[model samples]
Target chain A: MVKLTLNVVMAERNITSRELAAAIDITPANLSILKTGKAKAIRFSTLAKICKVLDCQPGDILKYIDD
Target chain B: MSKWLKFGINCVIVLGRISIVFAYLLIILPLGNFYPVIKGTLPKTILHNDNFLLLPGKHTVTAAAMQSFPSWPYAILILIGSIILIWAIIKHLKALIIILTNLRDADYFAVTTVGALKQLFIARIAMIIGDLFLASGNQLTRSWFYLVNNDGVMGATWSSAVADVWMAIFFGVIYVAYRYTLTLKAENDLTI
Candidate 1:
């Protein structure tokens, strides 16, 4: 299973979901979906935007968990 | 922003209401005139042959007569069917009004429009079933009195408005497709 570490990264950066969502020009609900690992898949463009906003690499925000 | 379309929808809504009232009046007025006759003939039973099997070249005809049955039960079934049809029509009209209103407001992709279309489809199915029931009731009543004509041919045939049923089913399929598209659009809209 693939898990999102967006919440951890956001926490380390001292950024709220609302602020991150606004910075990325995305809805807070969608950010919540990604943070909760409920997203089916993430677009590379969206990943790039999130990584740029949070000043992190894709690997820092995404993790592959063994089921 | 077509004025003609708005005018058309408004006219349909008004016409729908008028037709509903007219149908109710038709039912009520007839009941009023037939109440006394029906009361006087209350609980009346009738008996008649249901089938006549003609043996091949045997010069023998076997006729089976159904037992005496009260006419009121069939009458009540017809009345119930009529009421169901009326209710279905009203539901369809309401769904149409909602769809038109949503279209006018440029909310064509709203979930309420999908819900209304589903309701209209179900109501059409209900109306078709109701019509079938009414037709069966009519056939049953006719069979109670006469099943064969003077030409020795079956006279009381079970029949329904095939065109109406097919039309309803056709529109139901279209609505189902439209609803599916709306569902897809709604999901896409939420997929930020």
Candidate 2:
């Protein structure tokens, strides 16, 4: 199974959904969805956007967990 | 200014107004029509229609025929387009269901579904408009061809052109509606 720890990362960084969206140029609604991990696919550009905003790596936002 | 702040305020105001409107439109309005029913029984008919069955005009007939062509290529295109539209709609609806189901305690799945739903809605509307344009064009083409061949090619060419233009305009209105209903932003994730 694929596991995501976006909440942990967000909390650790004290990032707000609005701030993140502004930084990445996405709507907060869209950012909220991604944070909650409901997104089916993430674009590399969006990944870069998120990485840049959060000051983290792609691995920090998403990861694979054994089912 | 802030997206969340704006979203939060808009949602509250819109939802409150929507509820009030929903009450009037769905419940109050229906009950109000039953003044005698409140005292006796409801009206037998909800509408005051005279059972009119409207048949299409020449132009409308042409458009409808074009839209419903029996040609294999058109059939395949429509089938594929419909399937894609349905898929997008289903995905979005499923996302909404997830969110509603977990409102009190939303999980990642619920949140992600919201984003997915928005994207799907945009995509589905766009696809539908494209399909309509193609279908409309196909129909008008056939109509013009029949008009030219049967009724002396040059005699009614101008009239057929006018009809074609009207059909295009009608489809244009539908396209505009599809665009207006969508909430869109450039995707950061998607790059050329």
Candidate 3:
């Protein structure tokens, strides 16, 4: 099972979902889902865009928790 | 818009856009390139020109001759083909919209399933388009439409050779899209 945790990353960066969405051009609703790890998949391009905007690696935004 | 209508609208819009794209890749590009070859060379070569005296490998039709093969007829055919294909897609989209609209009042879970179906449809269309490219007998068509058959000009047909590299590139793109839409469970959940 794939488990992703991105909320902690956002919180650590002091980035609101709205702000992150604005920076990445995704809807806040989508960003919220992504942050909450409810996103079933993340585009590497989008992830790269997020990394560039947030000044972090994908590892910063995603952590896999094994079930 | 409700998720249902929004989803339906997105389906229509995406289908229209993709259909146009397919026309360009499959028919327009080949036929467009064909026009020049036909109009510039045909009559002179068909009866009098010694162009075909050499075998296919030995004979490389000149730019002018290549452009003259189908000439006016090619253009007319291409124009007709584009119109018909576009119309067919529009009709298809309308039907889809009607079906999706009826399902609008469906439960969220049902709506989500419909959304997945839409994604699957999109993926399928991409794959079909890719296959058409491979079948188009050119590098540009072969590579843009699919992956397995791009051996380049000599590897297949004149068109296939030209489209081979491009097909390779698009194959990667299709693979990525297929992976995203069908494989990545995490991100797909959101789209659903």
Candidates 1 and 2: which is better by DockQ? 1
**Total clashing pairs for each candidate:** 0, 5, 40
True contacts kept of 1: 0.05
Best by TM-score: 1
Task: Kindly give the stretch of ten consecutive residues in candidate 1 chain B with the minimal lDDT sum.
Answer: B148-157
Considering summed lDDT, which 10 consecutive residues are worst modelled in model 3 chain A? A1-10
**After superposing candidate 3, which stretches have Cα over 4 Å from the reference?**
B1-192
lDDT of 3 by residue, A23-66 (tens): 88888888777766576667788888888888888787566667
Candidate 1 lDDT tens digits, B109-171 = 777887887888788777767766666655664455442221111121233446557767887
Q: Candidate 1: which docking quality band? A: incorrect
Sort by TM-score, best first.
1, 3, 2
Give each prediction's DockQ, rounded to 2 decimals: 0.18, 0.08, 0.19
Error in Å for residue A61 of model 3: 1.9
**lDDT of all the models against the reference?**
0.66, 0.49, 0.50
